[model samples]
Target: MDFARLTGLIAATYTPLNERAQLKTDVVPAMVDHLIQQGLRGLYVCGSTGEGMSLSSADRKAVTESYVQAAAGRVPVIVQVGHNSLDEARELAAHAAQCGAEMISATCPSYFKVTSVDALVDSMQVIASGAPELPFYYYHIPALTGSAIDMPEFLQLAGKRIPNLVGIKYTAPTLFEFQMCQSVDGGRFDIVWGCDEMLLGAYATGAQAGIGSTYNVAPALYRNLVDAIEQQKWDEARRLQLVSIEMIRTIGRYPFHPAMRCVLGFQGFDVGDCLLPQPKLSEQQAEQLRSDLQSIGFFDWAL
Candidate 1:
């Protein structure tokens, strides 16, 4: 996809909220600015980290509009509107286009069996139909999608079948799918590494950029990592990678959303806590996280 040619520090942003868990739309602009100032190349708004599943349809649109408007064409903003509900996804895609997002993305429908390659292709086609002019990349996250698309099936229609189908945010640990994507028209399709911990490895495997959850915490460090890779400074990249390795692997297995909520709280944003089906980090753990961050010298001033 032709999405700003964005290739570094694409923050998977958080949707800030008030104490009521209502959409606190105002917090977005400042957050986006903060990341930009910290050296972010792009913003991946309304994604898994943004707690899209925790938002209402209209709220999602508002959040996307708020960020896109705040960005004001300064940088690329990718709106992840992927949801099981086609109606919601379409609404979000249209909202993103109206607000001037560079690209739109969606996860395949899940929670029920959506078997067959035809189903995946058809669903993606429907998503692409929402904003035909802008490119749409399929979000490959089988664990969250509750469905899987074999590599052959995914590569077959990434471009030939769907004209605007540009690239993919391949999220799982399996590099095999990404390798297949590289094999099948690497020029047309931009493959982004979605796993945070394996970013350095993915970068070596032709993952031009990465969309990740932890960028909000330390964007500069990631920017440094990317730069180090470009400069062939493997040691620097490994050091920063070590700093963020914990959360990338363990977030999904634990009460991560709430932990991120706590981190944001410490960062001075009133993003509040995670809703039901997501657990909050323990007060002790949260405090220790802050302490550990201080020890690592991350966000000392709490912007």
Candidate 2:
């Protein structure tokens, strides 16, 4: 398959819920429109940012359908279908393809903890086979998945086994390993950077694209960072990167995803709060978050 590499900023989108924490899919269209208007280049549905692991399989499918329909070919929607059950992951991948998603991605099953490159390849092959016509990207977030298989080796082996395998969503901070993954098969894979705060470093190491949760709220800031890099303005790029670091630090003070929802609320998106196991912010906490962000001029530059 001749895959068109994903370039520019792609948002790891959030799943909206109601007060009861049920799926509030009606908000999806508005969310998609807002992301595109904010200059995001693509949408990554049902990833960590979207609480994919927490949602039921049915809800994941619904969210995939909603995002794909909302995007309507305006931007590519890459559905993250990873599940502990390979069968469920395969089903989700097929459903994403059936619903018209442009690509599919999945993490290795976390519960069993794949310990070998061959095991990782076999596991992903089961998921990618379901969406044989569409491109597949292995979601390599070792911190979350607990499967820290060497990416360069896995890419080389999986490339031969999985016919539609295109590349990886490299999320770890190890730029050395990331660069090695990029060099595999003579740069055949589309290794998209996943860490938003370290995006400048990734660009310095030859990253062509990035998929991150922060891109949802701060696309303009990252766009300017990329622009500075493209224009060879090292000082401006470093300054913009520092702004992202500080912004992430402020959000990190609270439970990350819930605070991200609070930030979205500030922007009038009404995305509601994260589900349990990820706590929601109180009124006072939300106010304090707003103040911290204001102190850093986040509202001014996040646009």
Candidate 3:
């Protein structure tokens, strides 16, 4: 296991698509350059923001390949391989390791959800074993998974069963459980905060890193947020956190995925639309979104 600590803003990137919502692997290089320019610490590919669950396994593999290729050792790439099927998740995990992804992460199986901590640990162990060489982080986003098992307990059980388990993408709102997870085994795990809107609260609990969709659009704001909090500049950190919360709330008025894609389009990526069932913004809506963001000074705060 590589055990290298993942810190700072790890952007949960959007999967670039063509007008037909096909994977536009070609756009990844430009996307990489755009993020690097924003000073992101790492990339979290094929996760919630990337619409990983909506994509076919082949498409996920292709996106992972494109990101690893484009990053070209510039930054660490953590690939999310969680799927409803353990075999499919294992397959993707294997492919991620083969392609040189720095780490692999997975959320609970949602369709036939694992309701018990032991069951969740069993599920995670199988997935982690597939990529034994790479560091593995269990993605704990109960809001989406509905697993709702106690995370602190999950970590205690998972730590013993899965040797490669290094940390978690701690996405739940329960900060008390989050604090317990962080303090497990004398702060043994690297708990990266996943809720973008309430990041300051997480930072106060000793969260050194975060992963979020908003980081894709405004890396400077979050990078500065991290700096401000670290420097004990509470006033500045609070202000930045409010701006982030407002920006997310504004874009979230529409279907969040599509609106964020539109925001990226505004950033010059032309990453295209979110896949169907996720909804696509009309050109008029997209224009209005851009105008609204501008009115709120998103561009000014954005990198």
Q: What is the lDDT of residue 183 in candidate 1?
A: 66
lDDT for each residue of candidate 2 in 22-123, tens digit (9 for 90 to 100):
999999999899889988989999999999999999999999999999999999999999999999999999999999999999998999889999999999
Q: For this target, which candidate reaches the highest TM-score against the unseen true structure?
A: 2
The lowest-lDDT stretch of 10 consecutive residues in candidate 2 is 268-277
lDDT of 3 by residue, 1-303 (tens): 448788788889999899788998999999988888788889999999999999999999999999999999999999999999999999999999999999999987999878899999999999998899889999999889988998888888888989999999999888888888999988888889999998999989888888999999999998889899999999999999999989999998889989999999898888998887888899899999998898889999898
Candidate 2 residue 172 C-alpha distance from true site, Å: 0.3
Number of residue pairs clashing in candidate 3, backbone atoms closer than 3 angstroms, sequence gap of 3 or more or interchain:
0
TM-score winner, 1 or 2: 2
Give the lDDT ranking, best first: 2, 3, 1
Q: Give per-residue lDDT, candidate 2, residue 205.
A: 94
lDDT per residue as tens, model 1, 156-264: 7656667778778888898877767866754556777888888888888878789887877756667777888899999888977876685444433446777777776
- lDDT for 112 (candidate 3): 86
For candidate 1, the 10 contiguous residues with the lowest summed lDDT are 246-255
* lDDT of model number 2: 0.95
